[model samples]
Target: MTATDPAMTALAHSWSALSLLHGRIEGSVERALQTEHRLSAREYSLLDVLSRQHDGEGGHLQMRQVADSVVLSQSATTRLVTRLEDRGLLSRYLCPTDRRGIYTDVTDDGLRLLEEARPTHNTALRKALDQAATEPVLAPLVRAVHQLQGDIPRPDDRP
Candidate 1:
């Protein structure tokens, strides 16, 4: 169908609505984390992932793997890792077997900071979602968004 077609118009509106919701929720969470914990949303996300890895074992993921998991570009992830390293939140090391590859792991300080920020981040997100759900016009979209998240597999759930 053409861009101006009714079906296309409806699809565009749907995408726009989803994008707006994402921005709103993300902004709220980011502000809360940054204000209370001095951590950006992306930084908190990376720390959370590394904390999980730390719990599972001492194994660390390569830089590229971290970039993919956190939906960041390689260059951006590299910069972020450098920032976190400077803050004593994480460390990077060359792979023992493959010298070309670099692995990243969360430090004790990173885990502690993540633990401090998690509650703030989660509460902000939940409040935003709950507010949206209370609005009759947005309730269906909110429910759909929640369901979509549930449908996506977590790392451990993947085969």
Candidate 2:
């Protein structure tokens, strides 16, 4: 399609709007988390993801999985994990069954910080969404976001 095609223009506009929405939401949450907990959003996300792991079979995530979940490159995620580990907020250990694999877990301090920062993260997210919803270009995306959340069935709802 030509650069100026109507469909191409529409797609570009949609992508731009989506990017803007993401930037605004992330910026708001980042500021709130940093102010309240001295944590970057990426760090908080890593802590949160690692905290959900369990001793049950298949409960723990691999390093690559953690990277994918946090939307970071493997190297970047490793660096982030190392920083948190140095701060005593996380610990890393070799995988039990696979000597080549490693796993990271959140520490007690990380959990405490996550709990405290949860409210700030959530509040900042809500405020950002509410603000975005007021804009004509972003309102539909915001509604879609809420709709997608509602559409996901809870674990308890699985048959």
Candidate 3:
């Protein structure tokens, strides 16, 4: 379909709205996290992800997997890891089975910071969505998000 086609235009508009929603949420959460815990959103996300690792087989994630989860390139993820490591918030180690593979884990300090930032992150997210829901174009998207999260009851749940 041509760029000017009605369907194409609608698709572009939907994409733009989604991007705007993401940006608004991230920006709000970032500011709150940074102010309250001195942690950036990405740093908090990485710490949260690493904090969930376990001793069970396949519990720890490879660098690539961590990068994918955080939506960053492997090199960038490594750099972030290094920075956190320097701050004593994270530690890296070579995989026991494969010396070639490395894994990162959150330190006690990281876990403490993550726990403290959790409420701020959640509050900021809720505030962002609440504000966005007041906008005519974003209200539906906000509703859709709540519906997906099961925050809003589905029609199927109605008697």
Can you give the TM-score per candidate against the true fold?
A: 0.85, 0.92, 0.91
lDDT, candidate 2, at 43: 95
User: Which pairs clash in the backbone of model 3?
Assistant: none
Model 2, range 1-159, lDDT digits (tens) per residue? 787999989999999999999999999999999988899999999998999999999999988999999999999999999999999999988988999988888999989999999888888888899899999999999999989866333335566
Best by TM-score: 2
Error of 1 at 140 (Å): 2.2
Model 2: CA > 4 A from native: 151-159
User: For residue 152, what is the lDDT in candidate 3?
Assistant: 33
Candidate 3 structure lDDT: 0.90
Cα displacement (Å) at residue 125, model 1: 0.6
Among these predictions, the greatest lDDT belongs to 2
Q: Which pairs of residues collide in candidate 2?
A: none
Which model, 1 or 3, shows the larger lDDT? 3
Please provide, for model 1 over 61-116, each residue's C-alpha lDDT reduced to its tens digit, 9 standing for 90 to 100: 76777899888998999999899999999988787777997778888899899998
Q: How good is model 1 by TM-score? A: 0.85
